[model samples]
Target: MAPKPTSSIRSFASSDRFLAEIATDARRPGYVLAGDESFLYQRCRAGVLAELAPPDQRDFCLHDLDLAEVPIFDVLDRAQTPSLMVPFQVLFVRGLKTLYGRGQKKEEFAAIDAYFRRPNPSALIIFVADHLSIPTDLRRMDMQDKERFERIRETLGDWCGIVELSRVDEGDAARWLAAEAVTRNTQIHPDAARELVDALGADMMLIASEFEKLALYAQGKQLFLIPPQHDQAQPVADIPTPTITLGDVETMVLAAKQRSLYELTDAISAKDRPRALALLHGLLNASDGGEDSAIGHLYMLARTFRQMLIILEKNVRDSRAIWSVLWHGFRMPPFAAEDLIRQARRYKSRADLTRALRLIARADLEIRSSPPDKRLVLERLILALASEPKPAASGSFHQFAIDL
Candidate 1:
């Protein structure tokens, strides 16, 4: 049997692992860095460039091209050329969609696909998608684009490794913040890290930038970087600094900014009326988009409750099983998978979630219809969602089974 096309693609969650793979493997000629998330892709590209050439040699060894501006033939020419100052020439191509996106340049793509078969070993050719050309949900991509996406995937699947550099989820983002803090010679309390992640919502670039600012804040307060003690047990005598408290995180990272609407979703799931109200108020008052923001919250809440309804109706118990199904079907944040399962129990039947969806749809319509007091309408909806425990006149749904 012919090998499965996906078998050759490698996905990496850790920046360390991805960088290490490219650094250690000198023979891998090309990589397709897919996904719309630019921050992760940039980091991976930076690692490859750093490995391929030093700053001084980059002028001579690195070639950057955007398919939108330059032709594929030009890109191929650059990739084929060897570096004069370094062992490897780095060829970076951005906007892979220009080639594969609608208005198919069959001849150009055919040439590029052929090159992937035997790319120049002396140059690292990387094709990157800076933003979602095709839908992040591949199923949402039109049949034409989906076929184009699959063709590209299969063509480069064996010849070049495919790296999906997408955003990390809430849990992974929190863990990354903590790990990054350690690297910066600082410490973040678990709660503080979680707060940062919740407020930021997995924008890795923003999270990293905030960490730099936090490091300075800690240093200025003299709360980080304890003095070395020669008498300490180990030869390395530097003492650990104090942990960054949640308060510090709130003051530094959040700075009274409106929390993400995701918190409101959690609040509604947990049925915390007061918290949900407060979050809704903050989102309405502080969020920039006003009515648009309100609609976004409704959409998110509706979508989340709908997913929970599925889990409840199916009575999916094991976390692994739930995640496996959700991973392929819906894109829930991995960190919140367990939370969703737990919250599913609050629903007595599918009717509750279905009613909630109706309420959200109603709210969306009201906002669009130009209500005199839009916030008032949303607040009332929140109260109703908080107060209602189960759907009225509902069909039977399997009870959520809690493991002992």
Candidate 2:
């Protein structure tokens, strides 16, 4: 009915407008810049401070905070910095949740609560969290994400307005491509632009940056013409004469898919089935052409499984978390810790994995064992592995559960 808000606000204070208001308030310089991601916080701080700060501190205070390690209190408290004569100081407590992860002796929440009470007025205290889940207690905040806009309105009880990023549909993508073409002085074929948007999805930053790059490469080639090197003539006298061609897009797509596939293989070897599956899916979709070579695909899959067997055999004895596979064996995607736990449970024991490996081995052999039918063999192997359940590894295994 009204408008959708981009991020959730656990309280009115979490709203960006209120954050700006905090900067505007000469009376109240101290405020918490807490939000899901530090990106918004950093941007907000920089913009507001640029308006208010004197020339020097403006640049220094905006981004210098070491959010990953600074103890919340050490920054939040009205403590002295190396220099004091400075007119005003802003305390940016970046990545506030990382504090909770420190070991026993370093626990500092009690001190943090105390620091929150008397923050420095001269300094605007801003805390940024990339996601609510970053905080040990913040995950619960997501339930409020759906009702985020309304909740902010209610929570702020009178806080601030959010400059939200709009969610776009297919049609919107088209409109954006046309309007953007004129702005950057580059002509984008509707199809090429749409393809780029869909592949990139809805990340605003990605869309903006990529568009600019496209404009740069597309410069002078307004009609999306083939380059001079190709020796292709203009299809239409009216077509603006593009310096770049769809061929360039095709090449990039192939390169991305190849890298993504190899990455998938690495994930599989780590016994990180979930990451492995995600990488496979990404590779499948990232390319314009699907599965360039069936024999090549089969080879990759077989190698992945073979590597997995080696890691599993050693890990069965070491019994370390599955993640150690990344460091000890081939590296996979940047999988999260929770994914490792979930993927681990699916491998009931080394035997189940061994069985899966055999199917893949046979598939690989089938491909080279004869003339081909390689595509069918590879697909069959994927299905065989896909059929097996990969429950989240609860780290619940006893006596090397290898039924094989």
Candidate 3:
């Protein structure tokens, strides 16, 4: 009998839906799963394999070919040839691009194009690429490489069922976390879900792993809140939860509060010199106190000020415009983005933000140069940046603030 026609390309936001449809059902003859997010693709691939055959049967039916090392023709030949004992065979081929670069061998491309036209009835061939799509920046690739990538997509489009498994944004991430918590027989507060999404950024696999830890932690517990001390009958302890809260997130999930980073930025914006210096000191001293610690502080502070400069130059009047810039440019969470927008208004002009970045860069360089007193250099830099400037710039001030 002739094989079934290949299904049209379908996109999945998460692995759960894909597993429910593909893994649990009769396996298709061919699949082309492509994405830049390697971890998500890997998880989906594992799910596919688990449902394809049993552990013992996998040895006989399964074939993994690293196309980086294996020839395309060899992969095709094995996929076409049926296994004697197994009713169905699975061929996993990776690294579709040829050895030299993104371009494909004409012969190999033709071979794959042909196979997709008339795929094997009993074999399930999967072409997986962690970097199937190119970056949106056209300048990053040459004309030849672009054509090569286009050819690859065209070839895959001809025969295989293509699916895009891209990363999720903050809102989607929050919903996914809530659903995940429910599956684990627990619940995550809406605020707490947003907090988790913001803290972890957009790595779904990392989020999944962290969620598992939280699930285990909250397995048999119920959510509770501590009453105000004056209202409380006694001092409350042992906060347990099936419903995870923001406090639970800080204590259990996050190693350090990301909000503190924004708080430090807030202090700098308020132009409260003493408070800014003290906050900077506390930040450097947190986790592990050393020269290396001060180095990251320099980078982070410089980045924050640069962002503030962007906001200042753009004349962002509303939170919506601020969010648009941050979400698109920096992938910053909505809550933090709003906070930054509010703070950016505090800066009078571009020069103020520029001056702050200059001070941070000087401190960063000194830290890297292995100065004897790294802490003193950092403190001096912080004081200079946070403090109001005098009408007449001092010689010592210029000495401390090297020309950037």
Evaluated with lDDT, which candidate comes out highest? 1
lDDT tens digits by residue: candidate 1, 1-404: 11111211222254445566676754478777766665666677777766677888888888888999999988897787665667878888886777766776778868776777767888888777555443333445557545655776776677777675545656766766676677667888888888777666566677778878877887677633444444445443454574677767766664224334556767887779999899888777655546776687677777788778878887977565685456554646545666778878777777677777777787789988988888898998887777654432345454421211
Tens digits of lDDT, candidate 3, 50-91: 777567898899888888898888898888887898988888
Model 3 Cα displacement at 127 (Å)?
1.2
Model 2 scores worst on lDDT over the 10 consecutive residues at: 1-10
Q: Write the per-residue lDDT of candidate 2 for residues 1-404, one digit (tens) a residue.
A: 11112233322223445444544553343333434433344445555565556666655544346547665555644434433556666655555446534564233645544543554545555444333422223433445443443433343222213333223334455566566566555666766765565555433345556666666766634534544554455354545634334444444433223445555544653556667666655544443323345555655555555545555565533233444554633533222223334343445566766666667666666756663454455545555565544443468553222121
- Model 3 misplacement above 4 A: 1-26, 57-60, 84-87, 97-104, 132-153, 217-241, 252-256, 274-384, 388-404
All models: lDDT?
Answer: 0.68, 0.48, 0.67
- Using alpha carbons, what is the TM-score of model 3? 0.63
- Name every residue pair that clashes in candidate 3: none
TM-score of 2: 0.43
TM-score of each prediction: 0.56, 0.43, 0.63
RMSD of each: 11.5, 11.7, 9.0
Model 1 local distance difference test score: 0.68
Better of 1 and 2 by lDDT: 1
